[model samples]
Structure formats: C-alpha cells, structure tokens
Target: MNLVKRLKICVFTFALLFIGTAVNAQITNDITHEEAFTALLAAKKNAEDSNVLVNIAVVDAGANLKAFIRMDESYLGSIDVAIKKAKTARYFNMDTGKLGELTQPGGIIYNIELTNNGMVSFPGGLPIKNKDGKIIGAIGVSGGTIEQDRAIATVGAKSILE
Candidate 1:
C-alpha cells in the first residue's frame, strides 16, 4: 500500500483502540472475593480497636452478600441487620444513615425503607466505590452503638480504595 493509505489505516486503528479502552474503563466490575475479604478485615480491625464485637457484611455490585464475619461475642441478632444494611446501601447507592434521613416523617421519601424486602435505614451501612468513583459494593456493620457501627462501616468501605 501507498504511504498515505498506510498512514490513514494506522490512524484509524489507533482511534479504534483508544475508543475501546475508554469504553472498557467506563465498565464497572463487581467486587472480587479478595477485595471483600480486605474490607472485612479492615472493618474487623476497626471493631477491635473500638473494643466492640460486631457483625460485618459485604455485598457486591448486585447487592448480593459477598462476604460476612461475625466477631466473637457479637450480637446474634445483628447478623440479619448487617446484611440488610449492606443491601440497603447498595439498593439506594447511599449510606443507610443518609437514607434514614430522607425517610424520616415529612421527608421526600418517607417510608422508603418499607420496600426492598425491608431495609435498615439507620447507620452502619456504606457503599464501596472504586478509584474511578464507581460503586463496586457495600459494607454494613452492627453490634455497637450507631456511631461506632458507622465509623467501622466507613472504614471498611474506604479500604477498597487502598
């Protein structure tokens, strides 16, 4: 082929490659098992530091339970709470506390928690986002006071960024 024709073809190929890469970058993937464990470990560490036994739940992009851990002496009743918290965060793409605020009486979305097979609109739930700002999963913690659960869940969710 002539030099000019070859140059044009090369440019076209390069453009196609660039477009493909951009599209791929925009595709958000689910949180892997390793990442889920990492988040669980980070959350466990936070609970230990706070001297609280808690149940932690991690859910993937689909809001399915990905991993879970119940610390020793943790409240058995907290198992479902933690799972529901994680699912609620993923279902709304916001923290449970924020959802709670929006669901309060006279709020725009009052009684929203009554849907989604029941959700926990309190604290202790946070959505996990990747470096590209895409939500990959969520983490929920329970068994401590609301403040402690929120702090621990935040730590777990943010750990995926590291």
Candidate 2:
C-alpha cells in the first residue's frame, strides 16, 4: 500500500475509536460499589437509630440492583419491596411517595404502577443524586412504617454526597 493511503487509514481508524469511546461515555454514568456500600451503611445506621428493622436496597441508574441489606428481624416480605422501591425511584427519577400520590385513584397517574411490572409507589424510595445533580442511583427501605422507611431511605440517598 502507498504511504499516504496507509496514513489515511490510520487516521480513520483513530477517529472511529475516539468516536466510539465518546458515545459510550455519554451513554451511562453508573454508581460505584463503594458509593452504594456507603449509602447502605448509612441506611442501616438510620434504621438502628430509629429502632426499626428494615430491608434496604440500592439500584443503579439503570434500575439494576447494586446493594441490599436486610436487618436482623426485618420482615421477610420486605425483601422484594425494598428492591422494587429502589427500582421505582431510579426509573422515575423521583421519590416513590410522590409517585404514589400521583398514582392514587383519580390522580394524573392513576394505575401507573401497573405499567412498570408492579412498582412500589409508596414512601421509602429516593433517588441518589451526584454533586452535579445527576441521578446516579436510588435507595429504598422497607419493613417499617412508611414514615420511618422514608426517613431511612433519605439518609441513605444523602450519604452518597457526604
């Protein structure tokens, strides 16, 4: 091959590689396990402080489970609820309680929970936002009253920034 042709091919290849990397970088910003663990630990501490046994779950921006913990004596049934709550928060980019309010009968999003393979549209789910205000993940807590769960989940979500 001619030297000029070879140089042109090399340039083309490099351009393609750079473009691919840039696209991938824009596609996602997943949460790190270390951050998820910190959030979970904060949630556990909050639950303990509140004298509540709870199940906590964290999900990435894609609504995939990243971390989970079931405190001692927590309701076994809360395991799935915690995960669903996290997924619901990440999927909607908002707190599940707000979603619940909208989904109530005669509300704007009535029966909306049915659309997401059964999202938990109650309190206890919160989106985890980064310093740049990007929703990178979410935290969910279950096995307590709605108020307690919401408080615990809020603590967990805020811990990501602390």
lDDT of 1 by residue, 1-162 (tens): 999999999999999999999888643578989999999999999999989999999999989999999999899999999999999999999989989999999999999888988999999999998888989999999999999999999999999888
Question: Per-residue lDDT of 24-79 in model 2, one digit per residue for the tens?
Answer: 86426678899999999999998999899999999988888999999989999999
Error of 1 at 115 (Å): 0.8
lDDT of each: 0.94, 0.93
Q: If scored against the real structure, what TM-score would every candidate get?
A: 0.82, 0.84
Off by over 4 Å in 2: 1-28
Clashing pairs in 1: none
